[model samples]
Target: MVWRPTLPTKDNNVRLEVRKTYKLYIGGAFPRSESGRSYVVNDAKGKFLANASQASRKDARDAVVAARKAFGGWSGKTAYNRGQVLYRIAEVMEGRHEQFTLEVAASEGLSASKARAVVDASIDRWVWYAGWADKLAQVVGSSNPVAGPYFDFSLPEATGVVAVLAPQDSSLLGLTSVIAPAIVSGNTVVAVSSYERPLPAVTLGEMMATSDLPGGVVNLLTGSASEIGPWLASHLDVNAIDLCGISDAEEARELEALAAENLKRVRRPAAEDWSESPGMSRLTQYLELKTVWHPIGV
Candidate 1:
């Protein structure tokens, strides 16, 4: 009798895990790179992870357009309303705590406990910024005492569109620190996540998509920051840029030069401790101070 190989039984079959497809979060939607490109991401031990989209110049331009389009509505919302929306995002993020913890651990090469702590801090940071959304005007704006018989007041208004290069080292915490402050003041953002550790940022984007935050208010792109940074800096419509993630001095200067074409409010990169108290500087950086003088007897 001829020996025949038996088909594997159902009980002996190995189950395959369902992997996630990481894509760009733009205009409140996930899209594959228009360039049809992706790059491999590996773990700290050089283990195979997942592939992330490689954003192109076109993608950067599209993100700016989305941010510009959303700016009016987001900036028009009452401060109280923006606060509520930001708080809602924190709420949504809390539900995905486990996922964030895992991603943070994998992306940053931290132990589970440490990753949990980082995730916790990231969530709290978001809430902290949310609390300041409505109160910024009182702290930053002022009632001027003028010699003339007129009521003089100063108010903080949102800058149209901001481009952010999220910190490459402190993925989640640093990413949160830069993003929350910008959006809390009604400035829409086009942020580039860290090149090597972008998983946590992508997870954050997923949470934002399901939250009360308006689409385009915070668009996240994952790819080569060096490739996309120049396009964003030079874009005529971008109002401001945070260079906190650019590590090279020469490259930062080059980007700054490009940004000067539009006089974009440039936030030069500085060494930051993400765990430390984040002052009001970032919140006020992208705001425009508008003063109004009302005649005493009009």
Candidate 2:
């Protein structure tokens, strides 16, 4: 075997952008599951940059279990406490705003200004949802009038465990768009981030871990959507699913059927112009109703 150039004879002055590698941020510390599996994350040019875990079905199950276990306290948190915690997430997002802009630009091929807008939209989403934590009842619901002498009032409640298929195409905007709404309404989530752009998701997890979020409120898993989506849909414990950015109608329908097995609540695929101004439609999907009535004698 003959070797050629081992040293730099000429300074080509080549400066290539290197991708920052990451591991699955699970249960707080970044542990690569017992399976010890990883898959490649590529750049916009389709060049392999770093590895993301191929979180197995078992990983999905475990994440569901963690979310379930934490649901009691998280769902039980007072609206004020919940709002405080959710607001803190926006604070962390503010600190990492530039980091998200840079990562989104590289992976999603967005220009600097557009990527910055995307990051801003994501941060603002958190704050928007934060405002709803305590006030959704006043906005989307009201007391009902019965024919009898009784009182009837209806309001939203958390729907146990929600499995979210975070939007696939837009990295920061889509991921935050799905996740913020789910958690802000007091639902726990096991979200699969945009496969092509998971770095921002992992970074978001780190943000939550350090923020005031209680353990296991939001779990982020990175892997094949096709491989993992069905398991979450069919899992008996998963109370609902939101397939916001599925690429095909057939696959979306198939997942919907699986969710129907347990009568899981599903938010239909909508073509809402997420690029437009953000609003309360996302806030309503994750809500459940808790109606109370009392007999009144006049």
- In candidate 2, the residue pairs with backbone N, CA or C atoms under 3 Å apart (3 or more residues apart, or in different chains) clash, namely 157-288
Candidate 2 lDDT tens digits, 148-232: 9889888888988999888888777888888878887788999888888888888898888999998788988887778889999
* Minimal lDDT window, size 10, model 1: 7-16
Q: What is the lDDT of residue 121 in candidate 1?
A: 91
Instruction: Assess the local accuracy of residue 289 in candidate 2 as a C-alpha lDDT between 0 and 100.
Output: 86
lDDT of 2: 0.83
Please, what is the whole-model Cα lDDT of each candidate in the order they appear?
0.93, 0.83
The residue pairs in collision within model 1 are none
Write candidate 1's Cα lDDT for 1-298 as tens digits.
9997665678766556789889999999999999999999887777878999989999999999999999999999999999999889889888999999988888889999999999889889989999998999999999999999899999999988999999999989999999999999999999999999989889998989999999999999999889999999999999999999999999999999999998999999999999998998899999999999999975
